[model samples]
Target: SVVTEMTGLGAHTLRGYERAGLLQPARTAGGMRLYSPRDVAIVRRAAALAAEGINVTGIRRILQLEAEVALIRAEFDGVPQPVVAASAERGASGTG
Candidate 1:
C-alpha cells in the first residue's frame, strides 16, 4: 500500500513492474505480492525515471546496474583482506 500511495501507481502497474523484472517484491504462499521498504524505494526511483521519459527497458537496465554497484560497494566496504585476495586470484585465473 505504501508503494501505491507513494508512487500514485496502481497495483496492476506495480505487478507489471514485477513481470518486467524491475521489482522483486516478496510473495505470499498464496501468491499475493508483498512490498518491502526497499521495494518501495526502488519503485519510487522507477517512477521518477519513467516520468523522466525512460522506458521500462532502460529503467530495468539502470536498476540492474544500480543493484550491481551497491553489491560491489558492500563487498568492498566490509571485506576482510584474504577474501579480497581470493577474489582477485579468481579473477586472474578465471577459475571462479
Candidate 2:
C-alpha cells in the first residue's frame, strides 16, 4: 500500500523533480502519480534535503557521492553490490 503520511508536494516541486531527472513515479490509468514505497522514501528524503536549502544540482551530486560511498563500503566489507551498472547509469545521466 502507498504510504499516506507523506507531505503533499505542490505541482511546481513535482515539475522541478521531473526536470531534475529524478525517478519518475509511475502513473495510474487515470493519470495520477503513484509513488511506490521506495519512491515515497525518495520523496521524503528529497523534501528534507530541499528544506535544508539543498539545490537540485547539489542534491543530485550528494546522492551520487552517497551511492558511490555505499558501493565502496560494501566492497570494503566484502559485500557484492551491483556497482558497475549503477555507476555507469549515474555517469551517463548527467545529474551527478
| Model 1: how far residue 40 lies from native, Å | 0.7
lDDT of 1: 0.89
Q: Write the per-residue lDDT of candidate 2 for residues 1-96, one digit (tens) a residue.
A: 233345577666765776796648888999887877766766667778889999998877776787799898888667335766676688899865
Question: Compared with the true structure, what per-residue lDDT tens digits does model 1 show for residues 1-96?
Answer: 667887899988898889998878888999878898888888889989999999999999999899999999997989998998999999999997
How many clashes in each candidate? 0, 0
Clashes of 2: 0
Checking candidate 1 for backbone clashes, the offending pairs are none
Instruction: For candidate 1, give the lDDT of residue 96.
Output: 75
TM-score of each: 0.70, 0.60
Which ten residues in a row are the worst by lDDT in model 2? 1-10
